[model samples]
Target: MSRIQFDSVTKRYEADILAVDNFNLDIHDGEFLTLVGPSGSGKSTLLRMLAGLEEITEGEIRIGDTPVNRLPPRKRDIAMVFQNYALYPHLSVRDNMAFGLKRSTDLPAEEINERVREAAELMGIEELLDQKPKHLSGGQRQRVATGRAIVRDPAVFLFDEPLSNLDAKLRKHMRTELQRLQQTFETTTIYVTHDQEEAMTMSDRIAILDTGTLQQVGSPREVYNRPKNTFVAQFIGSPSMNMFVSKLDRSGDRPRFVGDIDLPISERQAESIAARSDADQFLLGVRPEHIHVHETSVEESVRAFVDIIEPLGSNDLLYFELESNIDVTSVIGNSIDIGEDEQGDEEEYKVFIEPESIPQRYENSDDPVYLTFDTEYVHVFDPETGENLSLDQRSTPEAQTESATGAGD
Candidate 1:
């Protein structure tokens, strides 16, 4: 296994288009690092540059201590599994698995066969050794392609959306298999994918990019719970985050957020906002899970109308519209208490409530419902720069939570 490093790496196409910009990262030995971003975000381009499939316009890429900018693809000691599987139609599974070993190294036929058998066994495709790619399912073809890379036993593994072709269930299964393989081999891995969920599930660390610029690199929990900026916040979460344009009102004893809607913030959040930035206004961000919908009015709760309700099977998403036109969403438990007289054995049963009977939910102009933002789970961001004001060099989710709840005191 080997650690890989990208030092101020950049890739440019023609005289204008910049694909990857001054990217720098250190992938630890045996680390599974994923490059994730939206389409045309340069994740695939960065992977290609490292694999020697594309040339770097600036900076250097090092595999272990060796700089590979001048090395050929065959000499990079890396194996890549592409999105399309890239399997040869004419070759059988065993031959396809052994193809790289045969051409790249002058190993004896017996040794190559042994390696192929081992890789096939490891990938659980030993039974399909003689089958051609045409006869295999998409998942099976994916395994064959991965087994081809495994037989090489390279120091590093590069996967470019290797499971993109498989169905959702198969993709999830393959994700588990890939993680297992990484643990078993402990080879350094760099995966490139546009799928944020896949990246979050598979990577030891995720490197997120946007428009060819590196955004954030952290563990899944770190990026999800304590994003450094608004872009990372909205991009990583499902249903995204609700951002409100607000001005800080410090005239009162306790500062509050006002503009799109009126809201209360913890004293600590207010202090952090004041100390970290000089702007008159900032954006308040709240994730769907952090917003609470109440059947009755509560302190600091704003009255809203239930614009829409989305029943996700596991959870129900409640969309609320404030009088000020701010759109807010809350994720609530789908399981509701069925009355004792109901047919169900259990007191609680999961079911989608009809739009008409959302527990006497608010109509556009009828009964008013209330929504409250969980201040401890909220984020304050610079409206201009989009940087999280609560973040410092040593701050983390726990720290932010402590500050918000006055536990730090």
Candidate 2:
């Protein structure tokens, strides 16, 4: 298996459109990395560039130490499994698995057959070896395609949304199966998908993309719990994180985020924000799970009208909007300064609150409700840059020591 490198890689189309914009990343040897983002986010384009299906407009890509920007797909020693399975309708599973090895190498018939058999066994499709693609189920066909890649023993494995065509239950099963297979083979794998769940569950590290630019690349824990920017924070979570422009105010010893939404800052949080230049005016982010909604008032709780209640069996999602409905369209679309839009009276800021902390009286009620959340869980971002301010707070030795001491006490 090889460690891949993308050094300032870029792709452009005829109309001066940038499909991928100077992407630079390193995929470690035998690591399972997933490229994930929304539609038209350049994830598939990036994958295709690596697989040699498309040309890089500029820069270089390397497998291990060898630059492969000019290499053909066959010479790259990369095996790809596509979303459609791409199995031959006429060829049996055994032949499909052996085709690449036969054509690419001088392996004898006996060795080729043995390799195919081993691949089928590993994929749990040993019994279906002789069946043609027409006779095989979607999941079975996917297995055969994977088996074909496996027998080749390529330097890297590329998967392009291979589970997109499967049913939900089957997709879940295949996700686990694929993880197990990667673990067994210890092959460097790069998977591209629009599904965040697949990326979160399968990848050792996930690379998040948006509009052709890389947003963040980190482990699931780091990406989900400690996002670097507004996009990462919103995109990585379920129902997404609530983002709103808030005004920061200081009154004597205390500080608070006020205007449409309200959140009080503690001494530690205030100290953290005090270290920043644009801390007084920035975007405020809080996940649904971090919000505590209530019918009864609590300290640091602010009132809002309940917009909706979505029940998710074990838990509930309570959505609320500010009474004033401050418009943050530009702030949400791009990381811009949140100025008071005199005509934005129609826009209401929305926040998702988990109902576990709410009283049953406010279950499905549309009445005014109160919300209380920890200041530690609140993430503050620059109004114009969208960069997380709390990350700076966490990076310092003083902050780390203080946080560690607080946790211990």
- RMSD to the hidden true structure, all candidates: 9.3, 5.9
Q: Taking the tens digit of each residue's C-alpha lDDT, what string does model 2 give over 210-296?
A: 778787787777678777677677677666777667877877667778865687776677666667744446677877777777677
| Each prediction's TM-score versus the true structure | 0.87, 0.88
lDDT of 1 by residue, 175-250 (tens): 9999999999999999999888998999888887877877778888877887777767767866567766678998
Candidate 1 Cα outliers beyond 4 Å, as residue runs = 266-268, 326-365, 393-409
RMSD of 2: 5.9
- The per-model lDDT (C-alpha) reads 0.78, 0.78
Which prediction has the highest TM-score against the true structure? 2
Clash count in backbone of candidate 2: 2
For candidate 2, report its TM-score.
0.88
Displacement of residue 171 (Cα, Å) in model 1 is 0.8
